[model samples]
Target: MKKILLAVAALALTAGMGMAETVRIGTEGAYPPYNFVNDKGQLDGFEIELGNELCKRAALECTWVKNDWDSIIPNLVSSNYDAIMAGMNISDERKKAIAFSEEYTPPPLSAYAALTPDADIKGAVAAQTSTIQAGYVAETGASLVEFPTGEETIAAVRNGEAEAVFADRDFLAPYVQESNGQLVWVKGQEKVVVGEGIAIGLRKSDTELKAKFDKAIESMKADGSLNKLITKWYGPEALVF
Candidate 1:
């Protein structure tokens, strides 16, 4: 981790930003609550605000970069950005490629929603590419159709491209609630445990950057701001730990 921080620091010096403490934070702006582009054409979401607060607490100047979900990690490794604050789950598979800060939220729930309560999910289910939800459907022997974004997954359901959509419960909840009878969670369906928890993604060598964010997260957790943020964005039913 220390080596990674030095690598980035060296890069910063070479780029003529010598001694600058700026960090570029990457996120998939398509994911709501975690991140999204607001109507004012500005980046806005729980993670965006949270990341800003973390940078403030850590005394690091930060900027936001929007990346596609499927390639978010690759971009990070390529130095397109320094860290990923997207709603990314911490998993052994990903850990091989990058290191993670301690989780900021408890594990998130993934669920299925269909146009009708009885829609046959065994047929075609939509999930974002490279997501655990997609892996779950494929492993269960269901037809797993991948989309690049959560909105596309839901669109696949409404357009008959898929029988159902699988995604984070918090992400799909608003769509289901606003769709009236047009969409509903499968009756009696159990939420799937997609991964361990959501955390910031950093290069394996960026130990200092990771430590900075980890310390900020710990402070937030200790002061109750982390739980407050979770409840504010994910509702009272949101999990905390």
Candidate 2:
């Protein structure tokens, strides 16, 4: 997915524009490090923490909303929440339906994982629904199996339901490292380093909200908190700036 700027004027009716004080941050509570629900049944993750910090820096009253990743954007268009803080990439196609704040996290590669290093991923690949990695798998010779959550995609490979799992490298890194020699990043898969920066998705009409978040992101970058959080969650080698 390549990054593209959004046109807020085209989405005038999509934002909860009048409420300058309260903004509901939407996220998929299934992706860890980026976002997830803790054992306490409360939303917690890097995105949640960063979102709260942004709200705090912007002096805005904010609340969190959990939504399924597949329908996250549609629900946002329906006013389910004020903005989306999910680890969503800012793409040209998505920008048609919503706007985005300047990217807070730089785009990192999406990689493939399998039980063995040389697994034949020719016709069996798994990816989360509606993700760029899913689209990539679909275009490959692989038979694309879809799942609603990131967890399920990885599980598919483990259970022999799919030959390989495609997802963000950072998200899949821990799984590979924890698997001992059981799992590894797929080698010679004819892959391309595909992805764009991750940013907060907003209604195309929410210029005020977009401006607020952009300023917050810029502030965090300037103060080095953005890089700090990246390293904290995705490790030292993760992309910064």
Cα-based lDDT for every prediction: 0.91, 0.86
lDDT of 2 by residue, 84-162 (tens): 9888887777878999899989876788889887877776899999987888788787899999999999889989999
- Each model's TM-score, in the order given? 0.90, 0.88
| Strongest candidate by TM-score | 1
Candidate 1 C-alpha lDDT tens digits along 36-101: 999999999899989999998888899999889999999999999999998998888899999999
List where candidate 2 sits over 4 angstroms from the true fold: 1-20, 188-192
What's the residue-level lDDT of 137 in candidate 2?
Answer: 84
lDDT of 2 at 219: 98
Model 1 C-alpha RMSD vs. true structure (Å) is 6.8
Tell how far residue 199 is off in model 2, in angstroms: 0.4
Per the 3 Å backbone cut-off, how many clashing residue pairs does candidate 2 have? 1
Q: Lowest summed lDDT over 10 consecutive residues: which window, candidate 2?
A: 1-10
Prediction-by-prediction clash tally: 2, 1
Which pairs in model 2 have colliding backbones?
8-204
